[model samples]
Target: MLEPQPTRSEAAARPELTREMLEMVFDHVENGIYLVDGQGVTLAVNRTYEEMSGFTNVQLVGRRLDEMVGPDNLFSGSASLLVLQRKGPVTATYSTSTGRKLLVKGRPIFGDWGEIRYVINTIWDLTVVQYSQKIDADTARSQMLSEEDIITCSEKMMSVVDLALRVAQTDSTLLLSGESGVGKSLLAKLVHRSSERRAKPLMQINCGAIPESLIESELFGYEPGAFTGADRRGKPGLFEMAQGGTVFLDEISELPLHLQSKLLGVIQDRSFMKIGGREPMTVDVRIIAATNRELMDLVRQGRFREDLFYRLNVVPIKLPPLRERRDDIPLLVRYFADKFNRRHRCYKQLSDELVQRLQSLPWQGNIRELENLVERLIVTTAEEIITPADAQLEPQEPELDPDATLGEMMARQERTIILSAWKKHRTTRRIAAALGISQASAARKLKRALESDIGAENQS
Candidate 1:
């Protein structure tokens, strides 16, 4: 049985919809339409909603919406009310009485005084848009570009993956900053793969890898005689080549400040001309920038532009260092070993002691370093099982900059401790009680921790 719900009269008086309009709305709607008061009480239900629930308006008018969408099944914090507060549209998910899932998009209806009148929401049953999920599945494939992916048991790495996937849908400028070898490029590739632009080619450029003189020309093309050794026929630049696709700017921190303004201009105006071309051309290139450097600090020190930083930092996804995701060492090792084994025509295995040694050692170089170690173990270690002794590669954890803030360091330490605990116990309840938190809260925090941990690696 469901809990008894309060009605609209519990707070304010209810308003009426004209009969003709109400009939038109109820009759023409395919998705179930409903209105709810700020207090969560149901006010009106369209014909579609009535048919789905097998209940008349008289039976449901005064019931709480939560009766149908339990707190657990909801996306939480009513988006309708949020829209009402923000005076904007909001989207959310809800479960229906018929056990079908719904994607509810809503806007807050306001009175003349700008007060929240009621939340008018339409729920398009997920089944109707089921076919569109294939686009989402394809987006997922784009991100798996570096199939040498690791076990993201840590919270940070998981957060990065989820954020990358979620933000990939939107055409937002993204900045991915983390420690080196933390799979920054891999995550960037994933974002490209997960976006609607997956059909478009994903072009990658490393600002640090390219010569300083050629970086600008490479990004913004050159005319036939623009350069001393320009192409015979003017070639399209990366921005042009990546039209309708994504251009991942790796090592973005290395981009010269002189070029930052041009990059920002291109991103903002979505148009640029070749080095000597007079007319500007437009291209739709989603940018995912990655850098292991602290860009904010760089900006403060006058090395990076604040405007460029803001443009790219719309979503800052950080990848966790290997030391933080140590629990995944064996998993990654096995994945890489198997990959190298098939490639090298060798059957190499790791020993239990080697795994323990791996866990004990702090992997400063992160997943990339671990991968190299695995390959080395497979290639050179002659024993049937590769022991830690055969894996001579070791990384000394880098020291953090002295100017790193106390708050930042403490937050990082807290994350490390929490992630290590969750990994060790493998249960949120146990970790929560041990850390003196409510079980429910523990679960949420653990989820976020796992999200953030799996995405970013610590620099030190």
Candidate 2:
């Protein structure tokens, strides 16, 4: 049986709802509510706002937003003022003197003559909800794994994160060296969020992805008519846009030698000349560079500048491959499963046997490959429980016996290497070049590996 719903007339006819009851209902709402007049004069605030901002009713009521917002004032900014200025709804994030970060959305009510009447501001505490937390190794790591999305329980990754967080406070250049899809970009973001410049923009550019002809202008701004079809009135580059924040240079090793020299100059002097501009522009930004290749090797090959390598290597942090940190695979699998379930609005679970099987494989593509596999399983699995057969993983090599002799282990490893290189390069000569060995030795070893495989198949 359904309950009868009250009509608008019936609800208005109820005189039992008094002003005191209305105030109670206002205070009981989960989100903080703030009200102000058309002129930005504070009218009233609920109790939730008081607790969230550390401001009392007496302090806020009858005051102007301009009076409460300043360096030494109660709040750093007011969304109500922005609503008044724009005569529309405004959503913004600001800090309070009490060390709380808040996200507020202010909507304006209109008068009979189309004038602004009241501004209703709803607030949510961002500090407690999103970013701010105590920095203990165990607790913080767990919280970050769930909320911050860093997801790691391995000691090696934990130590890497700790070092990155510690150096994030300073302006030292960071060199994040790791394999592709190992979360170098995510770590860079974590560093930025934990730094003093969190409020500023984090500008990122991939050196390899951008074209050689436009890479220079993309790093340093160009004047109007500097090049064909350039933006009129000039434009700001990544360095200019990332002022007072951080610039993440992804695939820094792919940066051309000439541009590398300019980048080194920027790190050395904090300034660069714009395209077709006579004056050099000064910038204040922290640089966090990432590379999948060895910069030192590029330097030796004269493809990357040695000076730039040294400048960006002030705080070098190497992230281990996924195969090395197998402990995090299960956690990552569960996280991705839940994420895709919510996204696709479906209920799915991976079988325990499937998880164990996944953990055994070499994740050559790292966390990214695992995440993609989990999403695919969640979306494509016909049943609630996804089994190993649903994964359709490629056939893997047999695991070596634990009691095998050192010589046997070496021979097996050599065979595996030769076989893997043969699959990719196909020819012994190409395999030798890829593996940095002679062509004759590659052919001999490849033949030996095939013979061993045939003998093992016969025995089986």
Model 1 residue 227 distance off true place after TM-score fit, in angstroms: 3.3
- What lDDT would candidate 2 get against the real structure? 0.80
Task: Give the residue spans of candidate 1 off by over 4 A.
Answer: 1-151, 392-460
Model number with the top TM-score: 2
- Per-candidate local distance difference test: 0.70, 0.80
lDDT of 1 by residue, 1-460 (tens): 9977757686355555789877897767887787887666778878886665456889768876555432343222344544444455554444444444444556677788977778887765432111221222212322213322323434456556667778988999888887778888867766765577876767677888788887887788777887677776666677776778788898898899989999988989998878988888888999989998778878998999999999888888877778876755765665567668867888788888887788777775678788887888788888989876677634536458698887877767777778887875568865775678887987887777777776765532
TM-score of 1: 0.55
Q: Write the per-residue lDDT of candidate 2 for residues 110-147, one digit (tens) a residue.
A: 99998999999987664432334232331121122221
Write down the TM-score of every candidate: 0.55, 0.59
Pick by lDDT: which candidate is best? 2
